[model samples]
Target: MKWQNSLKDYQLYLKIERGLSKNSIDNYILDVKKLIDYLDANHINISPVSISSEIVQQFIYEVAKTVNSRSQSRIISGLRSFFNYLIFEDYRADNPLELIESPKIGRKLPDTLAEEEIDQIISAVDLSKPEGERNRAMLETLYGCGLRVSELINLKLSDLFFEEGFIKVTGKGDKQRFVPIVDATKNYINIYRYQIRIHTNIQSGHEDTLFLNRRGKQLTRAMVFTIIKQLVEKIGLKKKISPHTFRHSFATHLLQNNADLRSIQLMLGHESITTTEIYVHLDRQHLKGVVEKFHPRK
Candidate 1:
């Protein structure tokens, strides 16, 4: 099959069978398109099915010189997945990347805020302003529930189950999970929803979106980052932070307080235990106590 046709099929497979998001599929396609561009520029005549491992390695080597280790590893993995899909479809008989290795890089621990630091950041918001209440509620919910920025902005009125003590979070790939919502978080949300959001003329196509811009539209990810950046600066915090830092802090705080890793994984909508395990490294004091209390030899 032609590479173009194969690419289209691969995209459809990722969306339908693999249930990947459009963004994810686009990234995968970009990876393959890079390979196609390289082959075309170099006047390599081999078809996708007939390409040898050496040619693929050459492409990887060229890419590695220009990209960081993380990006190079991602591109290599993307290509490996693409070729595996091709092999499954009987378009190729051999995999070119079976022997290839991903880059050796340690997991970078996520940045988290201490409870007092978070309080200071929240206190820095100008509550005298009209949007102050709304901003406070938004930040509180973000940190309290460990929500992704997307989840926070896309939250709906119907998704609020305060009486049931949970909020439904639609996570990556549209997977829905119920996260327990404490009264403190729910009360803030209710105040903003009823007092401020109720007065806005919500723009069309954003009627159901929870967070809104001053223009009554859905809040963009960039807007969320901007809010966090302003607060970080206002509080004179030296560490880098984003909306996601609230998420990391949520997980880290919970783990520090002895919340089970499995419970945190569920609440955070993490698919892998390894992802949640990063929080364990966030608190060295907690780790020392765990070893002292749990290890038989200790």
Candidate 2:
């Protein structure tokens, strides 16, 4: 079968059966496309079904030269998933990546801001401008609720449950979770929604969208990054940060203050407690304090 046909079928399965997002399906497709591009560039005429492990290995060898170990590992993993899909469909007998092993890479810890740093960044906003309140509210929600940038951008008006002190969040694979929202976060959001947002002429289909661009359309992920970038630069902060920094900070701060990992996991929408354990590692000093404060021996 043609490589294109195989890839098209795989994307459909990912979307329909696996329930992968468009971004995820696109990434998987890119992995296969890289192999196809390599074959075409080398003038090799073998079809996907007829391709050998050696050729795939050669492509990986070439990929290793240009990317870091982490990225190389991801590309290899993507290709492995594609081949596994082929095997599952009975189009191919085995995975080309069966014998291949990923390189040893450390789990890089996420960066976080302290309370003061977060405050300074928010304080740096020019409240004189019309967008300032929106910016402040967005940053507040980001740090307060520990939201992913995608989740923040996709937040809707109907999702707010102020009386219940919660807001609905749509996470990875479209899983919905109701995260607690404090009055402070709700007040900030209300300032934007009631004051600034009311004046703007929202675009069609974006009326429910919580955040908007100058055109009153839904905010993009890139726009969120850009907003954080400008804020970091304005505050002259040295640490590299993104919209996700607030999320990491939210988890880290909670852990340091003696909040349980399971509760933090629920707040962060992490499927596993292990994912939340990284914050525990970040606050060993706090753990030591806990032992010193409450232990009977002390």
Candidate 3:
């Protein structure tokens, strides 16, 4: 099969069969394209169905000269997965990437904010400004829902089901799940909606959007990062913090409070429990407490 046709089909497979996010699918495609570009630059005519293990290894080695080990490992993994998919569909007789080895890299744990630190950051917002109410609700939603910044920004007014005690969240790959909302979070959101947002002349496309900028447009990812960064600076938090720290804290807190890993996985919108397991490291006390409370010898 032609390389272009194979790449397009593989992209569709990743989206439909694997349920990967659009961003993830694009990254995988880019990895494959990178390999193709390398081959073309070297004047090598290799088809996806006919490439040998040696050429694949050489391409990887050449890529290693340009990218970091972590990036290289990711490219290797993405390519391996693509090749495996091709083999599964019987498009190729043999997998050229079967002998490829991923780089040995340590697991990098996500940064989590402490409950008290989160409180401090939330408290640092000057509530006198018109945006303060929105900021408060935004932060509350981010931590409460365990939402990624992109999800938070794109959340809609129609997604609220307060009477049902749940909020519909559109997660990665456009997957939708309803998460329960507490009274405090709902109250903060309502206050922002009625008090600040109601008075503003919202832009046309952003009328249904929950969070808006000063100009009544939808909040961008960079704006969310800036808001969190400014709050961190105000509180003198030394730990490396970002919008994602709130999400990490949300999962960590729930896991510490005896919430099930499977439930947290669903809330965090992670396809694998392993992605949610990183939060397990955050609650050392929970582990010790579990051992102390359950182990007979303790």
Ranking by lDDT: 2, 3, 1
Which regions of candidate 1 fall more than 4 Å away from where they truly are? 291-298
Q: What TM-score, computed on C-alpha atoms, does each candidate reach?
A: 0.94, 0.96, 0.91
- State how far residue 280 of model 3 sits from its true place (Å): 1.4
Which of the numbered candidates is closest to the native, going by highest TM-score?
2
TM-score of 3: 0.91
lDDT of 1 by residue, 144-167 (tens): 999998899889888988989999
Q: Write the per-residue lDDT of candidate 2 for residues 1-298, one digit (tens) a residue.
A: 9999999999999999998778888998998999999999999999888799899999999998998899889999999999888899998998889888888888888898989999999999899998899999999999999999999999999999999999999987787899999999999999999989999999999999999988999989998898889989998999999999999999999888878899999989988988888876655676688999989998
For model 2, the local distance difference test gives 0.91
Q: Whose TM-score is higher: candidate 2's or candidate 3's?
A: 2
lDDT to native, each model: 0.89, 0.91, 0.90
Report the Cα lDDT for residue 184, model 2: 92
C-alpha lDDT of residue 103 in model 1: 91
Q: Against the hidden true structure, what lDDT does model 1 obtain?
A: 0.89
Query: What TM-score would candidate 1 get against the native?
Result: 0.94
